[model samples]
Target: MIFGTCGQRAPSVGESAPAERRKYIEEHFRCISDCDMCGICAVYHNQDPLLVYRDYIEGTRTFEEITEEYRR
Candidate 1:
Protein backbone atom coordinates (compact mmCIF):
# COMPACT_ATOMS: atom_id res chain seq x y z
CA MET A 1 0.00 0.00 0.00
CA ILE A 2 1.52 3.26 -1.17
CA PHE A 3 1.34 6.33 1.11
CA GLY A 4 2.65 9.85 0.85
CA THR A 5 1.68 13.34 2.03
CA CYS A 6 -1.98 12.94 1.05
CA GLY A 7 -2.47 9.22 1.36
CA GLN A 8 -2.77 8.70 5.12
CA ARG A 9 -5.62 11.08 5.76
CA ALA A 10 -8.41 9.05 7.31
CA PRO A 11 -11.82 10.62 7.89
CA SER A 12 -12.34 11.77 11.46
CA VAL A 13 -14.75 9.53 13.29
CA GLY A 14 -12.96 9.99 16.62
CA GLU A 15 -10.73 7.02 16.03
CA SER A 16 -7.65 8.23 17.88
CA ALA A 17 -4.41 7.16 16.34
CA PRO A 18 -1.91 5.26 18.42
CA ALA A 19 0.77 7.56 19.76
CA GLU A 20 3.75 5.74 18.29
CA ARG A 21 2.06 5.18 14.95
CA ARG A 22 1.04 8.81 14.70
CA LYS A 23 4.53 9.98 15.62
CA TYR A 24 6.13 7.67 13.11
CA ILE A 25 3.88 8.85 10.30
CA GLU A 26 4.06 12.57 11.09
CA GLU A 27 7.86 12.32 11.16
CA HIS A 28 7.94 11.69 7.40
CA PHE A 29 7.09 15.29 6.52
CA ARG A 30 9.79 17.91 7.11
CA CYS A 31 9.99 21.67 7.02
CA ILE A 32 11.64 23.08 3.91
CA SER A 33 13.29 26.11 5.58
CA ASP A 34 14.41 27.17 9.06
CA CYS A 35 10.83 26.99 10.35
CA ASP A 36 8.40 24.20 10.95
CA MET A 37 4.89 24.32 9.40
CA CYS A 38 4.56 25.57 5.81
CA GLY A 39 3.68 29.17 4.90
CA ILE A 40 -0.09 28.70 4.59
CA CYS A 41 -0.04 27.09 8.00
CA ALA A 42 1.99 29.90 9.56
CA VAL A 43 -0.06 32.75 8.06
CA TYR A 44 -3.67 31.75 7.46
CA HIS A 45 -3.60 28.63 9.58
CA ASN A 46 -5.27 26.73 6.75
CA GLN A 47 -4.98 23.31 8.32
CA ASP A 48 -6.92 21.80 5.43
CA PRO A 49 -5.27 23.26 2.38
CA LEU A 50 -5.98 21.68 -0.99
CA LEU A 51 -3.28 20.97 -3.56
CA VAL A 52 -4.30 23.99 -5.60
CA TYR A 53 -6.84 26.81 -5.54
CA ARG A 54 -7.51 26.10 -9.20
CA ASP A 55 -9.03 22.80 -8.22
CA TYR A 56 -11.81 24.62 -6.38
CA ILE A 57 -12.13 27.36 -9.01
CA GLU A 58 -12.71 24.80 -11.77
CA GLY A 59 -15.72 23.44 -9.85
CA THR A 60 -16.23 19.72 -9.34
CA ARG A 61 -13.73 18.65 -11.95
CA THR A 62 -12.58 15.08 -11.53
CA PHE A 63 -8.98 14.40 -10.50
CA GLU A 64 -8.05 13.71 -14.12
CA GLU A 65 -9.74 16.93 -15.19
CA ILE A 66 -7.77 18.87 -12.59
CA THR A 67 -4.57 17.17 -13.66
CA GLU A 68 -5.30 18.12 -17.29
CA GLU A 69 -6.15 21.68 -16.22
CA TYR A 70 -2.61 22.16 -14.90
CA ARG A 71 -0.97 20.53 -17.92
CA ARG A 72 -1.45 23.55 -20.13
Candidate 2:
Protein backbone atom coordinates (compact mmCIF):
# COMPACT_ATOMS: atom_id res chain seq x y z
CA MET A 1 0.00 0.00 0.00
CA ILE A 2 1.29 3.43 -0.90
CA PHE A 3 1.38 5.68 2.13
CA GLY A 4 0.79 9.36 1.48
CA THR A 5 1.00 12.62 3.37
CA CYS A 6 -2.52 12.03 4.51
CA GLY A 7 -1.00 9.80 7.17
CA GLN A 8 -2.99 6.82 6.00
CA ARG A 9 -2.75 4.11 3.42
CA ALA A 10 -3.63 5.45 0.03
CA PRO A 11 -6.52 3.92 -1.85
CA SER A 12 -5.49 1.97 -4.90
CA VAL A 13 -6.37 3.05 -8.40
CA GLY A 14 -10.13 2.99 -8.98
CA GLU A 15 -10.75 2.42 -5.28
CA SER A 16 -12.36 4.99 -3.10
CA ALA A 17 -12.13 5.33 0.67
CA PRO A 18 -15.09 5.85 2.95
CA ALA A 19 -16.27 9.38 3.54
CA GLU A 20 -15.12 9.43 7.15
CA ARG A 21 -11.70 8.14 6.18
CA ARG A 22 -11.48 10.65 3.40
CA LYS A 23 -12.43 13.46 5.71
CA TYR A 24 -9.85 12.41 8.26
CA ILE A 25 -7.27 12.17 5.50
CA GLU A 26 -8.11 15.56 4.18
CA GLU A 27 -8.26 17.31 7.52
CA HIS A 28 -5.51 15.57 9.42
CA PHE A 29 -3.19 13.99 6.91
CA ARG A 30 -2.50 16.72 4.39
CA CYS A 31 0.93 18.10 5.20
CA ILE A 32 1.25 21.83 5.55
CA SER A 33 5.02 22.06 5.06
CA ASP A 34 7.91 20.20 3.55
CA CYS A 35 9.19 19.01 6.89
CA ASP A 36 8.21 15.42 7.72
CA MET A 37 8.47 16.01 11.44
CA CYS A 38 5.27 14.30 12.40
CA GLY A 39 5.74 10.57 12.71
CA ILE A 40 2.02 9.79 12.46
CA CYS A 41 2.42 8.58 8.89
CA ALA A 42 4.98 6.08 10.03
CA VAL A 43 2.49 4.70 12.54
CA TYR A 44 0.14 3.95 9.66
CA HIS A 45 2.83 1.90 8.02
CA ASN A 46 2.46 -0.73 10.76
CA GLN A 47 -1.26 -0.52 11.47
CA ASP A 48 -4.46 1.23 10.56
CA PRO A 49 -4.57 4.11 13.08
CA LEU A 50 -8.15 4.73 12.05
CA LEU A 51 -9.31 1.57 13.75
CA VAL A 52 -8.05 2.84 17.06
CA TYR A 53 -9.81 6.19 16.72
CA ARG A 54 -12.94 4.95 14.93
CA ASP A 55 -15.18 5.36 17.95
CA TYR A 56 -13.86 8.82 18.71
CA ILE A 57 -14.20 9.92 15.11
CA GLU A 58 -17.70 8.50 14.75
CA GLY A 59 -18.94 10.38 17.82
CA THR A 60 -19.79 7.15 19.56
CA ARG A 61 -17.11 7.72 22.18
CA THR A 62 -15.32 10.69 23.60
CA PHE A 63 -11.55 11.07 23.54
CA GLU A 64 -11.38 10.38 27.25
CA GLU A 65 -13.55 7.32 26.85
CA ILE A 66 -11.25 5.71 24.33
CA THR A 67 -8.06 6.86 25.99
CA GLU A 68 -9.23 5.66 29.39
CA GLU A 69 -9.67 2.19 27.97
CA TYR A 70 -6.06 2.18 26.89
CA ARG A 71 -4.84 3.63 30.17
CA ARG A 72 -6.03 0.61 32.08
User: What are the root-mean-square deviations of the candidates from the true structure over C-alphas?
Assistant: 10.1, 10.8
Question: Model 1 misses residue 48 by how many Å?
Answer: 7.6
Q: List the residue pairs that clash in candidate 2.
A: none
List the candidates' TM-scores in order.
0.24, 0.35
Per-residue lDDT of candidate 1, residues 21-70 (tens digit) = 33423443334554454553453243322433223333333333433444
Model 2: weakest 10-residue lDDT segment is 9-18
Candidate 1: regions farther than 4 A off: 5-17, 34-72
lDDT of 2 by residue, 2-51 (tens): 34454455443234335554465456654445437765545445334466
The most accurate candidate by lDDT is 2
Highest-scoring model, TM-score: 2
Give the Cα lDDT of each candidate.
0.37, 0.50
Q: For residue 57, what is the lDDT in candidate 1?
A: 30
